[model samples]
Target: MVHFLPDILAFFFIAALIAQRLSVDLRLPDAAYQLITYILLITIGLKGGQAIANNASMALIGHSGLIITMGIVITLVALIIIQIFSKLNKADRVTLAAHYGSVSVGTFAVAVNYLEVSQIPYELTLNLFVALLELPAIILGLYLLSDKTHKLNVKTILAHKSLALIIIGMLIGALYGEISEPLVKNLKPMFGVMLALYLVHMGALAGAKISDIGSNKVFIVSFALIMPLIGASIALFCSWLIGLSHGGATLLAVLGASASYIAVPAVFEQAYPEANIAQALFASLAISFSVNVIWGIELYTQAALLISSL
Candidate 1:
């Protein structure tokens, strides 16, 4: 019974949801939420950059390509699932698939915390994979869309605030490895605190979307619940095939399971305005995000452990 309750950062998320359900009038300011986002993105970037600096290798290039392929495959599969099971229009299907295909940094942060709590060691370069996984889904979504009017803007995607911060942080970390040590040390302690704050904000937002599950209740809810399991299973198999460590496999599975609520929404709103962005966000943030935070993380970790031992 105790194990079923939310613990650690998840407690903040679940508490926020409960508060929202009770109409507690608790919410983080928009500016503060954005600030937290910036901090998290930069922190992940810096840490990953430092790791790459310490362990640069040609193998990373191969691994990166493989990860990108995984993102593409996930997006395609998600689209296929949506097309078959969902009555959403073509644009909405592609857009929603894009949301599932991309990685969620918030979820990644939680998984990282989970690994730390369990004393599991993962490749620091996993953040690099986080950055790598963001683009392919969006790009594929754009390409698949029937709308040919909006050209794929590589520069715009790269310059998106989230990716820019991460890339810049990585560059700084990679260039000034020793010099950035003090900054990383100072920020490391605040990582968990910031993530908890973010999740609190996220939970409130997700709670508000509870009524927005809309007409496709069965399909949306079913997909939201089941997609993470499918995605995590595929990722665990990939991790095993590549011989990733237990922590590495777990983190990868989390990334695979996560659905993007931030980056994908921002891009899709502008690029494909006709798509039902609100419903997509509701599905990804409210249902999928909640599922991952509450139960999926533990399941993925255990599954990773099993795969690593095989």
Candidate 2:
């Protein structure tokens, strides 16, 4: 798996570049993006739900809640630093905060594959954390950006497709458990294939957005690299404190380092129309996504090893 990692990443990245070259005439990347997101989300949700159903225990539920809380804390700490250091407008800062705070499904999925190939076992409930970490950062970022008089619309959030799919998958998992495994047998086997296809679209998206990030290139670039490191640092301490195994700690670090381009962007479109979504999108998809996928996992694993030894 480690040997093939470079090839897999290169294939998608090169494909994305090719797609970008041909994008003037075709909407192939967009079509792929829309189609694969639903597939990935549903598949991820179902897998997590099944794990939860099988392991149903108060401890698991409690751990899940703590994971969500960690996400909120990460968001707050990130926003605070961005607010102090960045010269971007309030809206952009909040947008960046939301993006950094949210989880990246692509990076998370890749980390899972890496773990599987490395023969390291991770908690199945880690699947649920992908979805669990999506919302708090978005809501908190927007809330902080808003004036005291502003009230967020709960209905709008609940209606989001990303959140809805997660809930739907969990409901199915909790009620049906593994009974529906046979039904999804075909789809289950295709998760890796589906992910590779997804990365192609991601690469294309990143290539397209990379050039449009405006004048604050230094700031954006620094934040893209630094924010993930900060998230990884926090998660390292928290995971060890919570007694997560090495694999679990590595995953938490990967997720901590990942920046969301999907769910958070959708949330921002409706919630913070004033914010510059393009910059946030570029930072997450173009820079941070690549950073995490390429070297971020290795960084996390190494960081965990270092921390455990200390």
Candidate 3:
């Protein structure tokens, strides 16, 4: 049930698209919806911090860091492999590269629950690493794009509100850590209620976005679907080298395979406002994230078993 919440959220996303298509008047109150989302974001961060506090250790940090570093490398390697498969320009490649490099916070949250249920132990402080890894790929991808393709100023990219919020969240999470109890407690119920409410609101937003999508973007849609699978394959092979257990390795691969729809697109939209936000969201919603949540876990599990059999 716990491993299912993220999927539920993803469904809410689809519902959003469908609702918009249906022209339903099911709209969330704007102020209330945003307020709920804001609280949920803070709560997720603090909850992650507390999880880390519970499992904090030097060895855990060292191990998780190694896995995380591998995650970054896996994303880059995937980018190279993807370039080999189908030609994408440097800007697109960098955009795609950044997508894979950062862990999907939602996916990471889901995988952690899976581990908890399966009785697998992973370093919870890895949440900090998850937060740490969120932006570098975007930064690196942007620089790669600037040097090789679309030349955008670094300042413009850095100044994005979405990116800024992520940086702030990570910084606050780090500084607060165990010190974050009171605030977290006060925020928890608010987030809990908000998460429930905003899920419905997001459905409406997605519906609106879907209504806006058009037939001219077929090529862009194809790219979004293909990229994450390419990223995940490289991650799976590299996972063994990271010394992750079978379950952990599979989860890590999924993390690497997943794209940051919420985090990346929000930031990228600001920096590359001309770039297709719909493409990113659809790719994540329709292809990558959907694949991961639906049958990807089972698929990875089977592959892990096969590898163990060998």
Candidate 4:
């Protein structure tokens, strides 16, 4: 009963989906959900800042760059893998690449929740950094997948409300940590409730979209199961190389394997509109949704045990 938060979240997500199936009124307004997401994201940034404040040292800084680099490389590799296994055009491939290249906040959130449920701790700054990895690879994916007529548009970047919020999160985190007092002061209680509310709303919304899942969801389903297995192994080995603890390595591996359905897709919709948003969205959502919801924790736990053994 105690070890059930992940499953509980999954349950709500599935329930929300069922509601969607039945055509129920479980729709969380886009603005409302987005607002919740913004609050939580800002909270995450503040948390990151606090982490930096407590453990101010070179050891922590080195890993942040490495983490972003890992995500960037993984994004490119995902594009290659999707192209090899699936039939997608250059434009479609570019869109898919960027989506997969970017990490999913929902997936990462689920993983962090799972970790805390299991009584494991990790650096908080990573919450903000996870979102930050795509600034480079997203642009690169555009260059790779966008047409010649589609020059890099600054409006594409600046126009995103969610993107703006996330970037604000990072800045607020940096500022809160460097100058102001703790970001987790009086705001923690409000943010805490906001996080749970946001998660519930997001869960309901995600489940409603489940019918969006179908027979064609296989390639994504398989990738969701397999990518983490591969990514976690890579992360484990990489973690050992960097001299991190086993737990940190496994979590980072989970991070590496994650696909960004939320942030990346939004970026692609603006930057590369012609790309098959449907396919990319399905694949990214499928892999990431399945992993964090059900399979990812099993993989993480199994991998962690195996790594511990070997």
For this target, which candidate reaches the highest TM-score against the unseen true structure?
1
* Predicted structure 2, TM vs. truth: 0.90
| Alpha-carbon local distance difference test for all models | 0.88, 0.79, 0.59, 0.62
Q: Count backbone clashes in candidate 3.
A: 3
Which parts of model 2 are misplaced by more than 4 Å? 1-7, 18-31, 148-150, 183-185, 305-310
Instruction: Please write out the lDDT profile of model 2 over residues 9-76, one tens digit for every residue.
Output: 54675567567867642224566767777877777788778878888889887877788888998888
Location of the lowest summed lDDT over 10 successive residues in candidate 3: 188-197
Tens digit of per-residue lDDT, candidate 1, span 169-220: 9899989987888997898899899999999999999988887877888998
Which candidate order results from sorting by TM-score in descending order?
Answer: 1, 2, 4, 3
Which residue pairs in model 1 clash with each other?
none
TM-score for each model: 0.96, 0.90, 0.69, 0.82
TM-score of 3: 0.69
Could you tell which candidate, 2 or 3, scores higher by TM-score?
2
Cα-lDDT of candidate 2: 0.79
Model 4 lDDT per residue over 137-185, tens place:
6767766754577787666756655556666666666656755345556
